[model samples]
Target: MKKSFKLFLFTLLFAYQFSAGQNQKKIDHQTLTWIRYYNVLPLTEKWALHSEFDNRSFVNPIHENLFVIRIQGRYRTSKIIELGGGFAYFNVNTQNPDADPDYSIPEYRTQQDITFINDIAKITFHNRFQLEERFIQKADKNGLLDEFSFAYRFRYRLQSTFTLWEKEQNSLKGTISDEILFNYGKDNKRNTFDQNRIYAALRYHFTPNLGLELGYLKNFQRRASGVDFYDRDIIRFTVYHRINRKF
Candidate 1:
């Protein structure tokens, strides 16, 4: 079953890439290096808080492009379903070397998500659907970042985790995930296909609650008009930590 699923995913990814090559949109390519720190604070068997910080860079060889901070509270209604809401702030800069990388673009986002987790034959599948309301900074007539606009988006991600090697619950695992983003609302009219991300990673569990993930992510995003696209190749490193409190 695992092999069959993996094969299907790879084939789908291959087909998507092939279609991308045939697309007529103007394309730009860049490399982004990203590192993330993630933490979970468990209040009870059914409740938890999640937080994350990220540093992302893109400037050919190296330069800062973005930074992000997010916090979320989650309720696990069942082993197979969970609900979460979060807020995030992002500071973004253009990747152009000639442009000042001062993080001129600041975005505030509120998000809600529904997640499903199922374990089957030592493999775990996770599906997450998210809706976001965004307040994004824009440039004024003077070219200063003093204006803002609102937009809404929807995203869906499918991910799988397989244990490659194990020592009790501490194991080395591999993960593959793909996500698609769509835009809506009154402010966003031109581009419906906002972005897509494909990720492959390896996670090493230090304990039942702590782990590290090293991964590669490919991201494609379209401009509001859907006439231009950005293809980003990202190298990602993440540290994961969790704490459980007993009452």
Candidate 2:
């Protein structure tokens, strides 16, 4: 069963990549490097809080910074189904010798997710639908970029996790996941940016709900409505924890 599952995951990933290549754009060499930290906190029986911080640097001589914050809640509907929603805030700033002195923009977003569990593995499907109205006070005054407008975007994701080996003390687990994003609407009418990502991960669990994961992430993106693609190879570390409460 374990071998079959692994084979299935490999086949699916290969198919997805092959299909994506047919529509891929020209490659870009610029890169962005970042470190992220995430924490999950329980508030009540069916509520939770999550937060993350990221520090990123662009390889381009002109480096920029991006920051985001989010808060969310989860509700359990049945043994196989869970629902969640959240709001997020985003800010971006750029510093370049050729550009103006400084620039900044802020935005907001909301999202939801559903999950299913089976003996073979657990699956989670989620979507993040966002509306961002950019505010560029300083940059606009300098006539560097447009002032403000609304952009609509959404991300669709599917993820699965399976236990490979289980013993009294520890277990080995495997995960496969994919996400695709679409951006559109008035401010982004040009369909400026989009992203597709796929990943495979392995975990070592000390307990049923606690584990450490090591993973490889393959990400592809299209930027600014041009026929240019950016590909990134990422190494990720993840930690998992779950808690139950009765009300």
The candidate that achieves the highest lDDT relative to the unseen native structure:
1
State the lDDT of candidate 1 residue by residue for 1-247, as single tens digits: 4644664476457548744673786877888889999999998889899999999988475677879999999999998999999999998765453466433678999999998888888888887889999998877435546568898899878788998999977889999988878898666777777878889999999897889999999888777665777788999999999885776
TM-score versus the correct structure, for each prediction: 0.88, 0.67
Runs in model 1 lying further than 4 Å from the true structure = 1-22, 95-98, 101-103
Error of 1 at 242 (Å): 0.6
Candidate lDDT values, in order:
0.83, 0.59
| Candidate 1 clashes between residue pairs 3 or more apart in a chain or in different chains | none
Model 1 scores worst on lDDT over the 10 consecutive residues at 94-103
Model 2 lDDT per residue over 1-247, tens place? 4543454466457547744764655675544555455566677765677666555445455465456676667676765566677776766664222343455655556666665433443433322223333333224545345444555566555566676898996999887777666776654555454677777889897986567777877777665554566666656666665444345
Pick by TM-score: which candidate is best? 1
How many collisions between residues are there in candidate 1? 0
